[model samples]
Target: MEKLYEVFPCSETQKVLLATYTLKDEARRDQKVSEFQELKQGRMSVAEYEAKFTELARFAPHIVDTDYKKARKFEGGLDLEVFDRVGVQKLPTYVEVLDRSLMAEATLAAMKQGKAPATTTTEWRGKRSGFGFKKGRSFVSKKQNTRTSNSSSQSSGSIPVCSDCGKRHRGVCYRVSGACFRCGQPGHVVKDCPP
Candidate 1:
């Protein structure tokens, strides 16, 4: 029953970055949002955030060749926790809060924080009905699961493990787009970067 808005930044830029993208990917993208608290109601993509952060830095601080060096300087900039971003959707496509307790807590807190009451709220609906989360079954297809099982059975300790970090990272999968959702990088197989 945790609230997404309460813990995240008010800037949608940072919010979307944290929500849609990953900390590991952020450095590569060059979108630096070091602090989760700094997020506001901005919905620029991670690509956009990376672009703007660089532009602003150009005028004032100037650019350094070492991106890794810069990333290290910006600690706490990325919140890559799975729960923080699970079920996350990009802006202009915000999902409605279905949980009543979460709604009450956020609304009440907003009032005290000098925000206007959310007296008028819209219910979340998708393009098709009966197309939301359900407890018993997953949204995945049976064929997908069968295919995944076949692949894994074929690859018992015979392939690379770590999808991103490489070097056989334990417990994570190499196929993010496939059945292997190790640490959840989007498309690339963990063993091989997308080409």
Candidate 2:
């Protein structure tokens, strides 16, 4: 009787352990799926966002089982400006969508810097230069000329030219090659500069 009681308790404990293990795995998977579904591009660059999306996507394969579905999911997570630009293309494959999103990001950045106009999607698709402008007459000539004048004035100590990038600025040069003004790190801007 004593041996029978010990055997039954040991088997019950093993069963409980197995059930707990299964439940833990299912719970973890569920969490990962939830995170994947809620992923967004907020504040992150396109490459960072894409890497995270790929990392979490494996947990929820059914959500992106088809190429179209995968592309759509990726598109939906882009920033509003990039999404609007890329969405208009109606790209067929995930790779195409990803490529267009990267281009859109570059174009938008150029626009923000006054280097490109807010052109139609058709114009954007027509031609592109290394600086994300439509190829033709140099649109940057005016800006370059202004910078040259400013630099010449800076030589007389009237204006300040950033020694780091040779552009005119009043205070710390925060916009030079996207380096942090505080620490001079290349990957982050001033506001996101780490202590």
Number of the predicted model whose lDDT against the real structure is largest = 2
TM-score of each: 0.22, 0.55
Which stretches in model 2 have alpha-carbon errors above 4 Å? 1-10, 117-195
Q: CA shift at 192, candidate 2, in angstroms?
A: 45
Worst 10 residues of 2 by lDDT: 125-134
What are the per-residue Cα lDDT tens digits for candidate 2 across 127-171?
333222335644444455455445445444533476887975443
Candidate 1 error regions (>4 Å): 1-42, 62-65, 73-144, 147-195
Per-residue lDDT for 31-135 in model 1, tens only?
Answer: 443332243214543334445545544433433335433332222222233113322421121111112112333344445666443212121131123232223
Please give the lDDT score for candidate 2: 0.72
